[model samples]
Target: MDDAQPITTLSGQIVQMGHLDGSLIERMRHEALTAPAPWKAEYGEFQSGGWWTTSLMNASGDAADVRIADGSARPTTLLQHMPATAGLLACLGLNYMWVRLARLEANAFLWEHRDYDELEQAERHRLHIPLQTNTSAFLVTGGTKVHMDGGRIWRLTPTYAHGVCNLLGPDRIHLIADVYTDDAYARLTKHAQEPTVDERLPTASEADLSEHLATARRLADLGYTAAAEQLLLRLFYSFAMPEGTAYDLIAGLHTALGDAEASKRWTAAKSTLLALAS
Candidate 1:
């Protein structure tokens, strides 16, 4: 994959990827099996209860078997342990990144939604920085598309709608990481370079965000519903969580555009807000 071509998703966002034959993939796999940090559980019934469809890193960074050093487990925090697969990522100068081995079982899927706040903040570290943009895994063992081609490893601004499904017998695992700039990594190691609230607030300026909403609204006003929906996707990709105000505007726009699905979501959201207020 050329480092610059845009990789589009089934959901309409654009992302990119790196060639996967490097040493980092090997190192990560080695560390996954040999490292003492934590064990990634097989996709199956959880011992304690309902379907185990999603796994998350807590405020402390510890999962069922995973552990983040220094407890820097916040969603946007970079993990720095040198796993056996470190070389692949390091060779690309992605120093502040970490590896995640995820397994999504048969028929299992992730809904269409962007990553949460912290991860979005972490992503800012890679934003618009050419060399540091991230990619995902395109293949896995077993020669299967589910493990391989079905899910793409891309560095897209997917704060827009995106989803995945595992139709294969085995689970789907992804090695997710971000590109690290020399300056960013240096600052990251020192805990001094990450984006601040001031930086993020301005970077994700309301003007740019509003432009997206306005574009969608304009398209709807002109009767170009599909084009408007696509514009809405771009806005969603710009933020992990499109704010309540953004959602409210989207709801009205979609309603006017005759998109009941979107209107229903905003209606429910308003209902929830009303309930909270009452």
Candidate 2:
């Protein structure tokens, strides 16, 4: 996996599914960028600023209920404004648990974490449709970087550790759907294709880790606490390391700053988010 080569089907990666009409794709894009969404910022620790989401379908019919809950989903008011999106979702016909539009602004990041860990144990999958995205935006999973290109639906199993980033983007937006395994979903993914791009990230050596830690420390000493934390968090995107290395580094940074509670908090977060053995 460390070798620089195109990845095949693997854990925690996106598999390209069937395509959508170009015209429909355009409409989805327009609605994504123009819709009056009730963007909510949840999962604060799982992101590095600028990540927002609005529920289109959820257990509660409120768009602000972006935190996922396992239940029968109902349409939100935001979905009412998006006729094209509603129509498209209706056409596919799957058992949805939740649906949301996630937006990552320029320089934003979603830190490494597993999802659906808190939901009821059942067969579930996440589907993504890239409505608006830039080349600078991509997902890192299984040590491979995948730029989920538009025009097709993509399926992902988020039980494995993964992260996302938009380095220098126009905002990146995608319609994310969480669905249960059913006949319709089986048909939709029966012919799922391979992703177009799968680039392996550069491995981080001991020296690289030391240098980044030192830089973070310098920033912290200069009173740029948030910047220091983000610097360590961003390491996940730049190099391939162990599943929770960045979180460990962040905890270490807090310890060095004489904040024992903060250090403990990050340490606990790593365990919870990665679902590590107690």
Candidate 3:
């Protein structure tokens, strides 16, 4: 990836998948847990057992409604996720969609499902909005996992078959939101702005890298050796290909093709890559 390039998808969507600074998350946690409001469970219309609270919420909007197990109130949008609720409403210029605060413990997992149905053809042409952006569970703290921090944020599209397992002893708390965008911020403020509807998509420059790799695999799978060879050559020049053991396997494949020219290119590219490594 070019360091100067703003990593984005071919469509110019910004991808913001990362962990918040520890100090920031801690601050948010303190603000949420220490708030004056007593935690109250609210109900939801669509979900069977969904409920939420405002004890920790300091956001502008009203708290979410929840349908607790005790059948307290039918459903009320009273409780809310403090940091996420406030952050989404305040920064992104967003409105609409359900936001939830969830608690899950060890061996817990959410069944995979998409947020909203894919945009209709007509809607596709209209201005897009950030409809689904959810932070990870806050209560569940530890695991032998990729992102275990309570403050870790993952930009996910449930349409893509995502699931989570909580192997830790403590329960996990999540502040998930359904969002839609109303305005666009300038490039300078992009980083400071709320996550966008298309924020999960890879940036334009990174998409080039992704596309090239996908094409190479597809061609190889179809037994189109010659076509794959041609694409691989292009990728060699375009990307800083992976090095070491993977290099030997790639070079051996080219050599097996008996195309001395292709083999030479791969070898040369590998040499350049190794020199840079050194």
Candidate 4:
């Protein structure tokens, strides 16, 4: 593959993956909703309970490597059990790196975060096929809310900070695939649909920023530091802040609380998390 051409990043967050059979989607949804598969809860420090994932395909052949990757992939029993779903994957003909079924229970949230930051430099993308979802379940990316409707695959460039939420849902489930750029994927996405912005986040005024910082400081003082950090991190989805602004906010919050060491740690994390150069 030629390395000169820069991998295309969508002007907006979501893009359409080509069509899929509606019946297949319905069947997959039924299996997902009824299956007794072991759903592993999300273990990251940033999120609350209710998010779970089970792998269909991954690099280590272990369902637990939920993190993004840039290596060879293999399917797990979860994929084999649903032959129809495996058939759907075969139709795409793309070089997949990882595949999983992610379920978010009612009121669950994947707090604002960036992904693939720890992975090696490569042209990779995340695709979501909503198996079973409700209107309340949606993704916020680039400060725009998107509810990925069924019948078409949805692509998300997750390196940019984004979050998922299921405010009120029976259970939102999606077939998630991470694929590397290849001829098949390039051709499949050649006609990528332009993203429709459901809502654009309003720009925050200086006063608003100050108020938010104060709120975070109060939370930190109360010893709810993680909650404080999440409050600031969520600002990325609510305001049109520059990249890494959330990290900057957390660092500032620590500084205000007279925690120089904590402030310094967050300052360093900002660099490590947002650095574009591999």
TM-score of each: 0.39, 0.93, 0.36, 0.83
Each model's lDDT: 0.38, 0.88, 0.36, 0.77
Instruction: Find the candidate with the highest TM-score and give its number.
Output: 2
What are the per-residue Cα lDDT tens digits for candidate 2 across 181-201? 999999999998667668878
Kindly list the per-residue Cα lDDT of model 4 for residues 1-278, writing each as its tens digit: 11232112336468986888899999898777665566787555435578888888887776665765678888876676777888888888889988989988997777666788778888898999999888888777665677887888888888776778887897889999999999998898888885553666676666777899899888888999988987887675567555566777888888888999999987776665554452
- Compute the lDDT of residue 38 as modeled in candidate 2: 83
On lDDT, the stronger of 2 and 3 is: 2
What is the Å distance of residue 237 in model 2 from its true position? 0.3
For each candidate in turn, give its C-alpha RMSD to the true structure in angstroms. 14.0, 3.1, 16.8, 5.4
Task: Name every residue pair that clashes in candidate 4.
Answer: none
Best by lDDT: 2
Give the per-residue Cα lDDT of candidate 4 at 230. Answer: 73
Candidate 2: pairs in clash: none
Task: Name the regions of candidate 4 deviating beyond 4 angstroms.
Answer: 1-12, 42-49, 276-278
Q: What is the lDDT of residue 110 in candidate 3?
A: 35
Relative to the unseen true structure, what is the C-alpha lDDT of residue 176 in candidate 4, on a scale of 0 to 100?
A: 93
Ten-residue segment with the worst summed lDDT in candidate 2? 1-10
TM-score between candidate 1 and the true structure = 0.39
- Selected candidate, larger lDDT, 3 vs 4: 4
Clashes (N, CA, C under 3 Å) per candidate: 9, 0, 30, 0
lDDT tens digits, residue span 144-241, model 3: 11222444443333222222434443544445443334343232134432234321222334566556646765776688865664454433222332
